[model samples]
Each structure stands twice: as C-alpha cells, then as structure tokens.
Target: MLLMLLGTLGVVMSAAGWLSYRAGLQEAGEMFDARLVQSTRVLVSLVDEPLSELNAYPGEPIVLRGWHGEAQGVGEALAFDDGHAYENKLAFQVWDTKQRLLLRSDSAPTTPLAVAEPGFSDVVIEGARWRTFTLRSSNGRWFQSAELADIRQELATDIAGGTLLPLLLALPLMALVIWWSVALATRSLRGLSMEIGQRHPERLVPLDPADVPREAQGLVSAINGLLQRLDVALARERNFVADAAHELRTPISALKVHADNARHAIDEQDRVQSQELLGISIERVERLASQLLSLSRAESLGGARAHSRLDLDALVRTEMEELRPLAERKNQEIQLTLEGAQLWGDEFALGLLVRNLIENALRYTPAGGVIEVRTSSTGTHAVLTVEDSGPGIPEDERERVFDRFYRRLGGGSDGSGLGLAIAAEAVTAHGGRIHLGGAARLGGLVARVELPLDT
Candidate 1:
C-alpha cells in the first residue's frame, strides 16, 4: 500500500512538472510574439515619414530612386538619419507592393521572408528558427522585422531550470510527512502487541477497547470470549475431580474393613486363604486411594502460582527414609544420594512427586534388586532422579506412562497407573519437566525431574 501510494504521487508529480514546462514554453512564445509585433510597428513608423515625403512630390522619380538606393544601404549599414537604428543584432527588410525585395538586413536570409496576412509569423530559413512580423504602410511600401527563435527556447529552458531546486527540496519533506502519518496509524497495533506479549500465561485478561482500533475491535472481542470459555472448562474439570474423589473414598474404605474381617476367620485353612484375599484387597484399596488423590491434585493445581525455594536434596532424603522399610521387605537395597541441590517448587507437591517415582521403581524391580534416588543441581536448574535395577520400560511406552490410567504392556505392578501422571502434573505446575529414560547404573527405568532454580 505504501508503494502504491508513492507510485501514484510520483505519476501525478511528473504530469504536473510536464504541464508546467509546456506552459512556460507557451508563455515564452506568446511574449516573443508580442515583442516582435511591437518592434515591427516602431520600425514601420521610422520608414513611413521618408516614404510619405517621396510620395508627396509626384514626378520626382529621381528622389524616389535615390531613397530606394539609401534604403538598400540602410539594411547593412546600421545608420539612420535620426541616429536610432539598432546597434547590435536586429534583422530588417524592405519590399515593394509587388512583393519584390528592395533591401535586406545583413543577417537576413537570402530567401524572401514568408509573409502571412501582414502579421506575426514563424518561419525557418537555412535550418535556423526566426520570428518575423510584417507591416503594410499607407504608401506602396512594406516593412518586416525578424529575430532568432533561440531566445524563446533559452527562456523556456531557464524557467524549467529554476523550478527544479524547489521540486527537489519538496521530495524529502513530502516523504517525512508520509512516514509520520504511517507511524501514527500503526501506533495502536504496536501497543496491542506489547500488552499481549508481556502478560502471564495464566492471566486471562481481556484487551481494553479504548486502546484498540475500531477495525480490530472484533478480534479483541473474540479473544476475550475464548478466554472466558477456557476459564469455565478449567473450573468444571476441578469440580469433577473433587466429586469423584469424594464418591470413591467410602467404597474403598468399606472394602478394606470387610477384607480385614475375612482374614480374622477361625479355621486355620480358611484363615490362610482369606489372608491372601485380604492382602490383595488392601493393595487394591491403596492403589485406588493414591490414584484418586493424584487425579484430584492434577485437576486442581493449574498454573496459578509460582514455586518457592527449598532444598531438593533434603526433600529426596526424607522420602527415601519412608520407602526404605518397603524396599527392605522385598530384599532390595534403597540408596539415597544427595548433591546439596536447591530448587524452587511447592514442597508438598514435590514430595508427592518423589514418592510416586520411588514407588514406581519399587513396583517394577524384583526382589534383591537395588533402587537409587539422587538429587543434584545443574547451572540454573535442579535435578531429581529415581532408577531401579529391573527390566527397563520400552521407548514406545515412555510417553504413554505419563497419561492417566495408562499402564505399560507386560508390566506387573499393583498400581492404579496414575503415579507418573500425578508426578507429571506436579512438575508441570512448578514449571518443570519429567521424563523416563535409561538408568546410568541400573538397567531399569529412570525417572528424572528438572525444575527452575528461581521462583
């Protein structure tokens, strides 16, 4: 659009310049014609007195012939009885009523002047331009005056040259005005971009109409409408999680009590069988309770707040202490390694993340296997890793394990399959990431978490 506007302006300016040039030339021609006609009239008056005296005396043919002789010399001699003849460069000619040339100026062409209606005329002789004016007197005498047409052409050229400087000076000033208007027009858009770019991701604020242009009002309204919808959807998801957890807790608690009652049978054989059933039921209830809590936390904790500074190494050590007895019951050694790392995260949420990873490692590892928990720092981030000496998860199932209720194929774990999902939600809430990879010392699954060093 700017190019098109400049192009249109260029064309209009060019046309105006051309018209001005032609008009100047035409004006020069008109002034030259007027001057030529005035000079012709003056020259006619000069010769009229002499010719009238010769005509006043009839039969004095000798006087007329002598006057004619003087006129022939006058064209070349630049002499006048009144001492008023041109001194420099003017052309003159005298002719009879029969169109016979009586005398000619020294600079006049050898050919006859092309006279038309006894008025101004433009004629060419010997490839040179001339402006000629003819006058017929009351006597049988004619006068003609001519000047070079180069004078008019020179005047036109001078006028065009004089106009150039102003035209050149105007260009930059015109460009500045155009640029200023364009910048003013786009100021609203720049403000809009800055306002949107500086906002927090969780901030669903609507754009202000007063700061937006009329043309962009519809787009701002649409974006505000979308943010409202997302807020409603997120609210609904949180409510569903809270409702599901409340509903599932009672049934799980009742099942655990009934399983305990069954295990207290009087018969020894029945008691042994019922104890196995009670153990299975207890594991199932634990899995259900853990999954429900994870789902509720994942749904409720959107990216509403930033993390707080805490010692990540101390957090990992505390969680390992609680899991040590479970690892020992399976004849597995749980090792906790601390590197004195500090991280910014929610303490309670991060504790849940460490517990889930350790439990996941314990579930996959066989008896007598080793599980390692490590915490360290890397430049601007803190890292936590949990690995076990068991069959490692395949690459294809790594991402799926982070989804709700997504258990790996051929995996044997008494879990509700929400451990990794819950851990992922907590890490994401703290602006951190969690991934499953090959362990360095253990041939099993390695779960690593990295969180920012600053809140």
Candidate 2:
C-alpha cells in the first residue's frame, strides 16, 4: 500500500514539476522581452544628438563602456545601485539611413545586431545566442537592443526548481501518513483473525458483531452463520452415534447368550434349537447394523451425492417389481397409477426413498390389503404417493414417525425404524417435501412426496 501511494505521488509530482518549468520559462521570456523594448526606446532617444551632425564626430562611433568587475554572491549584481554586474551582457547599437554604425556600447558587436526589420529577433554572435529588438525612429535611423540568452534561461530554471523542491522532500512523510492510516483501519480485522485462530474445536460460538466495523460486518456475519451450522451438524452426529451404540448393545448381548447356549447344549435337539435362536439373533443384529449404516449415510447425503435426471415413475415401478413377490405372499395387491413423472435428483437417494415408502406400506398393511402407489407431475414438481389400506398412524404420531429409531407402540412390524427417517433425509437432500396423511377413499396412512421437476 505504501509503495502504491508513493508511486502515484511521484508521478503527479513529476508532471507538476514539468508544467511548472514550462510556465516559469514562458513567464521569464515575456518579462525579458518587455525589458528589451524599454531599453530600445531609451537608447533611441539618447542617440538623437550624436547622429544630428554626423561630420562633427570621428571616423568610428564613440562607445559607452560598462563596468567589468569580479563576480560576487546574493545582491552582487545590483550592489550600491550604481550599475548591474550584467551591464556588459546588455548592449545597444544605432545606425543611420545609409546603415553606417553611428554609436555602439562597449559590449555591442560592431556589425548590425539584427536585420533592419522592426520588432524582436534572435541572432548568434561569436557562437553565443542573443535576444535583440529593433525599432524605426522618425529620423530614418534604427536602434537595436540586445541581451545574452543564457541569463534568462538560468533565471527560469531557478524559479521552477524553487517551486518543486518542497513537494519532493515531503514524499517520504506522505508515505508514512498513508501507512499509519491503513494500519489503524485494519486493526479490528487482525483481532478477528487472532480470535478465530485461538478457538477450541468444540467452541463453535458466534463472534460478536458489535466490535466489527461496518465495512466488515457482512464477513463477520457469514462466519457466524457457518459456526452455527457446524454446531448443529456436530450435535446431530453425536446423538446419532450415541443412539446407534445403545441400540446395538441389546442385540449383541442376545447373540452372545444364544451362542453360549448352543455350545453347552447336551442333546442334539437342544443344540439345534439353540443354534436356530442364535441364527435369529445374528440376523437381528445384522439388520440393526445395516439400518444404522443407512441412517448415517442418509444424514451425510446433503452435499456428497451424485445427482442425475431420473424418471420418478420409472424408479417407483422398479421398486414395486422388486417387492411384488413379498406383497403377493401376503395375499396383498400392489396397485400403481404411474404417469411418468420426470425429476432431477440423486438416483441412489431417490431409489431408496421410493423403496422405503413402498416397503413400509407392505409391512404395515394387513393380509390381502390394497397397496396403492401413484406418480404424477404438477408442472414444476413431480409427486409420489404410497398408501396402504391398513391401520393408519395416529395424528399425533405421524410427524414423529420420520424421526430416527421411532416406531409406533403397536405397529405389529419388527422394523428397525430407520426406513422412514432415511426416506425423509433423501427427500430433504433433493429439495423435496414428504408428509404422511390419510389416503383418499382407502382410510389408511398415505406417504406423499414431492420433488423438483427436471426442467
């Protein structure tokens, strides 16, 4: 930041210096030109008496000598107000109508200072530059005043340097001021960084916005929101792990008991019975473990799923085909009114969602009950429904059924109670909605799901 500020200042100052130099040079030129004109008028008036009687004067024109003294400092040029040190640098000449040199100063060249043209002009004499101004008089003679060019240039350069020196000297100080201001402005940001770095992993508390500057309030707010979400996800994960441990302990203990019974049985029939019970316990534990894994996978399905365009009705038909034999063995009829609904979602998540709803229906409905499944669209959403003509859930328990490990008291099914929870998570991952309500004309629980359309 300091470098950038300093660089910008340097460029502006350089441009200002150049412009000042040009202005100084132009102003000095005008002032000197005016002095040349005044000097010409004075010399022309003074030369009247000398040219009136040309024959009275000698063969050469008389010269007005100037002081030739040692150079000094400060007021050296105009000391004592008698004459200037630069008097030798200022020269004048007068000429008659025949171009004869009538009068000249000691420093004036014997040759004509410039062409007979009236007004200002430049000339080179003895490899040195001079500025000359000529004027026509009523007597038909001409007067020319001249001065050295280098003197005027030196004064102009001095004026420009004097104007620009202070600004250049202040550049470092300006850089210091800019750096201090930037540091003061960012102090709060540094503090915020330190606070975040010092946080404990379990410390998901939000940062206070009161101390933050208005310019950075939005950033602080976003960070706080992230911390809040992380806290929620962590709490949920803890609860899931605790519940899974608790649920697995009972089945594992039963498996161990049956294994011991089978190992110590005396008779062959007793050993076989014990082995059968052991197999049942093992199956129960396996199913419980599988349900816990599904629940874990469902909870993590928000961001890591591969999504695709899927036919909702087609996925429903596939699950029905897989479960049709189970429904047939129970003497139950599986009814489907598939209307070919198209949706965009994760294929695995949506397939699981479909299968869970249908299987729950098959498990809960009595023998020979009707399982009604339907798929349709509402322009922006594709809808799915699986309903069974069985004892529907109580109105009070309908919402709780979607919670992990929740089951109705007398539902007559030995489910691990994660199927509905898994279905709920899959619907949420797809930005969909699901609800359990009474079926139309069937008087049983209806699980209706709605998802965004593919378009």
Candidate 3:
C-alpha cells in the first residue's frame, strides 16, 4: 500500500510540475513579446520628432548618435560605468520611407530588423534568431526594436525552472509523508495481527472490534465469529472427554467385579452366572461408547455438515428398520408413519438424529409398550416425532434433559443419558428446534424434532 501510494504521488507531482513549467514558459514568452512591442512604441514616440526635422542625405552614411563611430563601423567601443550583460541582447533602428537607415544602436544589425510589415515578427541575423516589433509613425518613418531569441528562450527556461525546482526538491519529503500516512492508516490491522499472534493457543476469545477501521470491520467480525465457534467446539470436546471418563467408570468397574467373581467362583453354576453378568457389563460399555461417539459427532456437525439435502422420512424408516429386532426382542410394538418429509441437512447427522430419538423411545418404553415414530413435512419444516409408552419426562426437567450427560431421576439406570442431547445438537446444527412433552396418543414421553426444509 505504501509503495502504491508513493508511486501515485510521484506520477501526479511529475505531471503537475510539467504543466507548471509549460505555463511558466508560456507566460515568459508573452512577457518578452510585450516588452518588445512596448520598446518599439517607446522608440516611435521618442524618435518621430527627432527624425522629421532631419533631412536624409542620399548616398551619405548614417551615423549613430550615442557612439562616436559611424553606423556601419565594426569594432567600435561603447563604454558604460555600470552596464548590464543583457544590454547587447536589445537593439533598435529608425528608417526613412525610402528605406535609408536614419539612426541605429550598436547592437542593431546592418540590415533591416524585419520586412516593412508593421507588426511583431521573427528574423535571423548572423545565424541567430531575433524577435522584432516594427512600427510606422505618422511621418512615414519606421521604428523597430528586436531582442535575441536565444536570450528570450534562456529567460523563459529560467522562469520554468524556478516554478519546478521547489517541487523537485520536495519529492523525497512528499514520498516520506505518503509512506507515513499509509503506515498510520494500516496500523490498526497490524495491531490486530499482533494481538492475535500474542494470544495463548488455548485462548479462543474474540478480539475487540471497536477500534477497527470500517473497511476491515466485516473481516474482524467474521474472525470473531470463527473464534466463538472454536471456543464452543473446544468446550464441547473438553466436556465430552470428562463425561466419557465419568461414564466409563461404572461399567468398567462392573466388568471388573464380574471378572473377579468368575475367577474366584468355586461352582460351575456360579462361574456361569458371573460370565453372564460380565457379558451384560460388556454390552453396557459398548452402548456407552457408541453413545459417546454419537454425541461427539452431533456436536462436531456445526456448519460443515449442513450442505447435503436428506429425506427425513427415508432416514427415519431406515433407522426404524435397523432397530426393529431390538424392539421385537422386548416384545415392543414399533409403529412408523412416514409422510414424505424432506429437508436440507447432513444425511449422516439426520440419520443419527432419527436413530437417537427412536432408540431413546425403545430404551425407556416397557415390554409390550407401543412406540410410535412419525416423519412429516409442513411446507417450511420437516418434522420427526418419537412417542413411547414409558414414564414421561417432567415439564420442568424437559429442557435440562438435552444437557450433556443429564438424565431424569427415574430414567433408565443402564443408559448413557446422551441420546436426547445428541439429538438436540443435530437439530441445532441444521438450524432446527426440538421439543419434549407427553405424547397425546401414547401417554408417554414425546420427542418432537422440527427441522427446516429450506435450511
């Protein structure tokens, strides 16, 4: 940015300096022309009276008044106590109508300064160009004033240089100022970078946006949003680890106890009983591990898995079919009503969502209990509901049931208490909502999930 700004400044300054120089040159040329015309008029005013009384002698040489030498003489001396170097650059001459030179200055060329035309003109004498102004008096006498073109050009160039020199000398200072201004403008960005870089790796808190420039406000907001999400994900991961450790302790201890009982049992029947108990403990551990994995997946779904469009009805049917044997083993009746529900969501996450709801229903419902699963869409939302013929959650505890590892007082003793929590996370990741209440028909717990079809 600094380099670009400096480059632009340099270009503009150069263009301005060139234009200023051109203007100066033009102004100087006009002043020089005006001086020439004024000098010619002054000569006509001063010489007309003097020349009219003088009679021109034919074939007689014209003698200049100021110098002792004749008008045609070369190498003649003219002395002044304090003469300027520019004196030789100006010259004047007077001529009669018959074209005889009446008077001349030392610097004037022997020939006429210009043609008999009565205005300003350019002429060359002795290989040097001159600007000349010719004027005719009322007596038909002519007066002319001329200056060397080289001297005029030199003066014009000096004027243009005077106009451009200051800018040329200040180029370095202007570039420095531009560089400093660019640095000052971008100091906020640098501060933001430094603030981020100096933070601890575990610190995922947002940066302050108040002092940020308007152009970078959106960028800072986006970064703060990402930081908030990272903080959430990190907190979830830490909680999952802690919860998994806590949940693993009971089943693992149970398995250890059963293993110890089987090892110390004297009777074969006692050993068989211990082995059975150990198998049950192993199953609980496996179920807890699976539930923990599902919780992690749901929490991690976030924004990354929200792209795929899935059929809620199809996913619900598939999960129900897979869990059918589990229901049949308990002599439970599983009723499914799929109503062509479609929504935008991750297929895998939505499948998990459906499985968790139905599995929770199957776990809590007693033997011979009826579990009703439904999938339907209402234009803007795809809804999935699982109702069970089990003890319903209390209204006060319904919201807390979605908390990680939270369970009701009389909930299933062997459960990991993560099914509803995982289901809730999945719904949230898809920008949906969940509600828990008593089923109108089943007279038990009802877990209703409303997922947006538009996403």
Candidate 4:
C-alpha cells in the first residue's frame, strides 16, 4: 500500500514539475525579450550625445572591455569589482540611416548586426546565435541590443531547476509519512487476523468491533454474522448426530434380539413368529430414518426455498396418492376437496409439508375412520387442511406436538414424532403458518397450513 501511494504521488509530481518547467522557460523567454527592448530605449536616450562626440573614432566605436574569458570563476568578477560575468555575453550597436556603424560595444561584431528594420530579430555571427532587439529613436538613430541565445537558455534552465528543487528534496520524507500512516491504519486489521488464526476450532466468538476503523466495520460485521450462523449450524448438526445415535439404538437392539430368537428357534412356528417381530422392528427403523431425512430436508430449506409455480391442490393430490395405501390398509375413507389454488414455493419442500400432515392423520385415525383433505385460497394466501376422525390433541398440548421427537402419551400411533415438526419447518420456511385444532366437521385433529400464494 505504501509503495502504491508513493508511486501515484511520484507520477503526479513528475507531471506537475514538467508543466512548471515549461511555463518557467516560456515566461523567462518573454521577460528576456522585454528586457532587451527596455535596455535599448534607456541606452539610446543616455548614450546618444556622448558617443556623438566620439564620431572621430568611427571604426573604433569606444570599446568597453568586459571579462577576458572563461578562465575566471563566475563570482570572481563581481567580488573584485570588475564586471559581472554575463557582461561579455551582452552587446549593443548604433547605426545611422545609411547603415553605417556609428558606435558599437567591444563584444559586438564589426559588421551590421541586423537588417535596418524595427522590433526583434535573431541573427547568427561566427557560428554563435544571438537574439537582438532594434529600436529607432525619434532622431532616427537605430539602437540595437543583443545577447547570446545560449545564455538566455541556460538562465531559463537554472530558474526552472531552482523552482522544483525543494519538492525533490521533500519526496523521501513524504513517502516515510505515508508509510507510517498506512501501517497505523491497518494495525487493528492485522491484530484481528492473528486473533482468528490462533483460535480453537470450536471457538467461534465474534471479534470486538470497538477498535475497528469505520471503513472496515462492515467487513468485521459481516464476518461476525457468518460466524454466528456457522455456530448455529454446527450446534444443530451435533444435536442431530446425538439424537440419531439415541434413536437408532433401541430398534437395532430389538432387531438383534429377534434375529437371535429366530435363529435359535427349534420349531417352524416359533421361527416364523420371531421373523415377523424382526420385520416389525426393521419397518420401525426404516420409518425413523425416513422421518429424520424429511426433518433435515425441511430445516435445510430455511433460506433457500425455490421460486417455482405450483398448484397447491395438485401438489396435495400427489402427496395423498403416495400415502393412499396407508389409509386403505386401515379402511379409512379419504374425502378430498381440492380447489385449483396456485402457489409459488419450493415444490419438494411443500410436498414434505403436505405428506407429513396427511400421513399423520392417516396413522392416528381409527380403523374405518374418515379423513377429509381440503385446499382453498383467499386473495393473498393459500391454505391446506387435513382433518381426521381421531382423538384430537388437547388445546394445552397443541403447540408441543410441533416439537421434534414430541408425542402425546397413549396415542397408540407408530409415529416417530417428527412428522408435524417437519410440517412446521416447511411452513415456516415458506413464511407461512400452521395451526392444530379440533375439526368441527371431522370431529378430530385438523392440521391446517396457511401459505402466501406469492411467497
């Protein structure tokens, strides 16, 4: 992160410096042009009369010697009161209307500096380029000032260098500050990672959010929420495993006893009786396993209900058809009033819900009893009711029947007590409700499930 910040800052600073350098050079060039014009006007006013008296020395032009050469140090001339080092790079000339050189500086060439015109111009002499400005006075004497083009360029470069030097020196210090700031900001996150890394497998405690940065608070909150959900899922799994172990033990023991009895029986009649008992034990175990699976499937659909359109009446009919044999074996009559009610739900989950309710009714009702299956819909809700002519649950114990592994004592039904719980699970997952009450028509338990048609 620090490297990224420094890299981005470096790129921005480089572009800014380039623009500043170009602007400085351009501004310096304009100032140099103005300086040439202003110096020409001032010198022509001051020196016109003095140099006129020296017209006798026409070719000699009152030469003023500056620095000799590059042999002297730059500050040596200024310190010793000679002349500035740059004086030799500057020169001036005067020309009369006939283009004759009336007077000139020593550094200037003996030939005419430029064409006899006004304003600024560039000229080359002895392979060295010079920038010259020409001014025509009122008296018609042409005053011209010239400077080395290389000197103007060198000064512009120096000015630009001076302007950007401070920033270059401060860049390293800025990078250090940025690195420190980023490290400080991420210190809490690093600590959180270490805390999670060293935790025990079963330790799903949430991290403290007090020290978290505002920017990372959401991340921490999401992680905590995930941990909370994982904790619940793990606890549920553990309970399921424990309950399965306990529930399977009795039937398996009975199967072993019955098998042993059948194997040890001396007579054919005794063996046949033991085998029948063994078969009953096997069926009970199968029923328990199937109910456990249904409960699991229903619970797992909590947040993952499918969004398929299905007819509630049709779905209930399908479930009822599968369980018709159980109702027939008991000589129970099934009276179904299925309307064409449409619903949006998980087809498999709704099947589980309907099957459990109808099967419970079929199992608990007396032989030759009446079971009524009905489906209907209000404007916003679809409802399914399975009522049977069996002893209904007492109002005080009505809610407990939905608990996992719960049963009303003395109910003589071979139920695993998971049927109504599975029904409840599916109904709750669909954002719906189920009620257990005495059926007024059938005079028994009524398992009525209500679901939203658009859920």
Q: How far is candidate 3 from the true structure (C-alpha RMSD, Å)?
A: 6.5
Better of 2 and 4 by TM-score: 4
Q: Write candidate 3's Cα lDDT for 1-455 as tens digits.
A: 76776678778777776776677667777998899888888888887897677675546435443323223211233333445446677888888888988777878877899998899898889998988998998999888889898765666566666667787788788878888887887899999999999999799888998888999999999999999988887887887898899989988999999999999999999999999999999999998899888888877877554667777777877888899998998999988888888877888788888898888888889889999988888889888888999988989999898887787777765677888888888888888899998888889998888888878
Off by over 4 Å in 1: 1-267
How do all the candidates rank in terms of lDDT, highest first? 2, 4, 3, 1
Per-prediction TM-score = 0.47, 0.78, 0.72, 0.88
lDDT of each: 0.74, 0.87, 0.83, 0.86
Residues 35-107, candidate 2, lDDT per residue (tens digit)? 9999988877777765786666568987888877776654554554566778888899988888988888999
Error of 4 at 71 (Å): 8.4
Which residue pairs of candidate 4 clash?
A: none
lDDT by residue (tens digit), candidate 4, 1-455? 88888888778777777777778778877988999999998989897777565636455455657765444543354343555667778898988767777777888988877777898999999998989999887768888999988876776666666666777788899988988899899999999889989989799989899988999999999999999988988898888888878888988999999999999999999999999999999999999999898888888786666789999888988888899999889999999998878889998889999898899999999999999999999989998989999988999999999988887899978688889999999999999999999899889999888899889
Regarding lDDT, does 2 or 3 come out ahead?
Answer: 2
Which residue ranges in model 2 land beyond 4 Å of their true spot? 56-63, 67-80, 86-129, 134-143, 148-152, 244-310, 318-332, 340-349, 366-369, 378-381, 429-432, 452-455
Query: How much is 417 displaced in model 4, in angstroms?
Result: 1.4
Query: Per-residue alpha-carbon lDDT of model 1 for 72-153, expressed as tens digits?
Result: 2333474566442342234777676766565566666545666635887778888877788888877767777787777676
- The per-candidate count of clashes, in order, stands at 0, 0, 0, 0
> Clash pairs of candidate 2?
none
Measured over all alpha carbons after superposition, the RMSD of each candidate to the real structure, in angstroms, is 18.2, 4.5, 6.5, 3.1
Candidate 2 is scored at a TM of: 0.78
Clashing pairs in 1: none
Relative to the true structure, candidate 1 has a C-alpha RMSD (angstroms) of 18.2
Q: Residue 406 of candidate 4: its Cα lDDT?
A: 86
